[model samples]
Target: MDRSKYTILVADDEELLRWSIKEIVSRKGYRVVVAANGREALEVYHRDHPDLSLLDIQMPELTGMEVLKQIMAEEPQALVVMISAYGQVERAVAACRLGAQDFVCKPFDNDDLLRRIERILEPVRLRHQVEGLLADQRQRYAIDQIVGQSESLREVFTLIRKVAATPNTTVLITGESGTGKDLVAKVIHHQSARAEQPMVEINCAAIPEHLLESELFGHEKGSFTGAGERKLGLVERANGGTLFLDEVGDMALDLQAKLLRLLENRTIRRVGGVDDLGVDLRVIAATNRDLSKRVEEGAFRADLYYRLNVLPIRLPALRERHGDAPLLVRFFLDRLNREMGKQVRTIGEDALACLSAYAWPGNVRELKNVIERAHILADGERIEVSDLPAEVRGGGAGGAPAGVATATAFGLPEQGIDLEEVERRLLTDALARTQGNQTQAAALLRLGRDALRYRMKKFGMLE
Candidate 1:
């Protein structure tokens, strides 16, 4: 490590001890700041903000314990080590309780003192690194990271902004699988008052019912078979932050009741623990299932349903937001290009049209997957229709007409024909045979009248 970046503070009333510490630490390439008394220590601390501090217990103006308390109150993360004589071991213990990192004895071996300081500073270095990583992750999940231009998606963004400003409001996001429900939950948490705190997530459906209770509420040591030590549950871990209960509809009825209690009381009891520990957190629950319908069917609790439905935000399915497909395609394309180190820039018109027309049953997630796959398989600078998945190219449910094989009456050609043009001509021919009779034309085309009318409108053959 480059010790030159670190600054250590040494505060001692004894000049000899203070000089000794400063000499030893400064030789390690660290900048050293010295203070002759506790009061001077606090003054230097506020001004310099050194990475670590070493203080003698028996000081002039203020004692080390008092100085430690003041430092902790001002800068909670400040690293301080107490220096005490052999007769002052009890006072050093007191200093540790007051947030001192570690203590060193007077007439202390220089090597032992140096080792203790290194141990304390090691965790501080690690914590800074971890915080940096977490900050980067939070940026990735920011509210603006969600991509879509459709009006329905805009409305969802409006709701997210409104709900996020209210730190304690419980959010219930309902949507189909792959519609970015989990992303929405994270956006809410990261943009809320508890953004600096941790956000704990649990997939209710992913965990087996037998072990879910212990997972949510935690289990005490020896609470069950093979329970070796106490474990903090997701609820306790999420205290003062956000708890995202994903696929909550799949949670068992018994566990649902326990969760309802926790929501109502803002307290949770571990599996085998007798005490009820209070928790302060916002609950954001998500599910693809129709919870109201489940309540009517007696599978879900009506009371819990009402409680969670307070700030309901329903996400529009990808098919419902057809206008967003092209934008989402470009978004994922750019992301995959950067990630996979591909030069695929723009998409071919045919590929773009195919993507816009397809009914993405899996929603935005499936679209992202398709884009990634295309980026990987693409041999040119642009993605072509042939680069897409067969289902997408066929456009069976997505919006295009059935594949060219459906036009086999004229035998298969070496090159495939446009399915939309073929379907349009077929519709016109059917209508012509029926003299423009709507019902008769539908029967000739082997399609329902409504289906025929929709096709007519889509092909611009309708007046």
Candidate 2:
């Protein structure tokens, strides 16, 4: 926006000519620095790193051609316009071959000079803007190198673009454990309008029933026993940003009423505080639970359910996303080798078959852990079936065979089958593995803690 702030370096041997050029460009809202010779121009160029450079062809120590070559070598895309006297047309032509943008003859019209400079700089300015935009986009979508080439991931990409454009809407993401729901939430927050603000997450089932309320809506000083000082709740701290409720279904019935009130009123009253404080935040709630079933069973509040389910997004389970298993396994293997400083390369055909054949009950998280375990214990570049955990390698009651049968047996199937029964078993297994740690269970299951709770209710398997 500040055109005058853009720096330009003018290099010419004649002091009068340099002064004239500097004055002309400076008047047109550009900062100008003058150098008496090419040697001095290179020094000033290094010091200032000016946006554009104007070099006189003939100089004392270093000729304009020499400076142009050095500058181009340093930055292949350096923007430099060569200047020559009336009879040095041949020299100017030679400068162009050496990466000079355009040649300006001596005693040239100032208007033509200005027009030429603008013409030369326009493309650079456009490229810089485009690159900045692309960098921002990459930062927004990237999630720790969780690469994907499947149609399922492509659909997720489309959903991300749509959701990012409307940051304020409440999003409900449903998926089996290990399906990357948290990763999706992070991508949405990173790309949203409130990216600069904080993203506060609360595990609804992690906190005790009595403490969950205070965790969400802070207690006032002296409001409760041992409430020594005033505290800000997760919702209040996430003001003007995003609040990710990971296990909303685990929230006590009393707290659910309060949460609904806050979502509706957009305000909170800290414990013992009288006045309500307003907040502006986007709510992204995830659960492995079936909210509709919970509502039907009179478990979760219907009003709150509808309020949170503004835009629904269901992530595909790993087993359902055909052909992505091998890609994921390789990605995890590469990550494992880099972190552990190993040279492990390929998964043996037997190992690859076993991986592809086994149901990834743990989802991506389980898959990653399995690969890490294998890489650490593997004897060579290729991991054999022996490297895998016994349960996964055996492919039996310990672990179901790969694909639909295994996914169903592990209760990871999201739809088409007995969806409720599948989710119920899945959440139950995740909870058992984590030893009732809803947070860890959610991580293992790749569902939000809240999502796991919903699934529990749908299957009547609440912990």
Instruction: Write down the lDDT of every candidate, Cα atoms only.
Output: 0.86, 0.82
- Give the runs in model 1 whose Cα sits over 4 Å from its true position: 1-5, 10-45, 54-77, 80-113, 196-198, 218-233, 269-277, 395-463
True lDDT of residue 310, candidate 1? 87
**lDDT of candidate 2 over 1-463, digit per residue (tens):** 3457478899999989999999999999888988888889999999999888999989989998899999999988888999999899998998898888899999999999999888887876787776676567558556545467776677877887799789889898887778888888888887788786789998887888898888888989999999999999999899999999986766777778888888899988888889898999999998888788789988899999999888988787775566788988888877787888998999888778777766577788888888888898888888988888876776443454444343434544455477666567777787888778776676565454556666777677663
Score candidate 1 by lDDT: 0.86
State model 2's lDDT: 0.82
Q: TM-score of predicted model 2?
A: 0.59
lDDT (Cα, tens digit) per residue for candidate 1, span 115-170: 87778888777877777777886788887798887767888999999999998988
- How close is every model to the real structure, measured as TM-score? 0.70, 0.59
Candidate 1 matches the true fold with a TM-score of: 0.70
Best by lDDT: 1
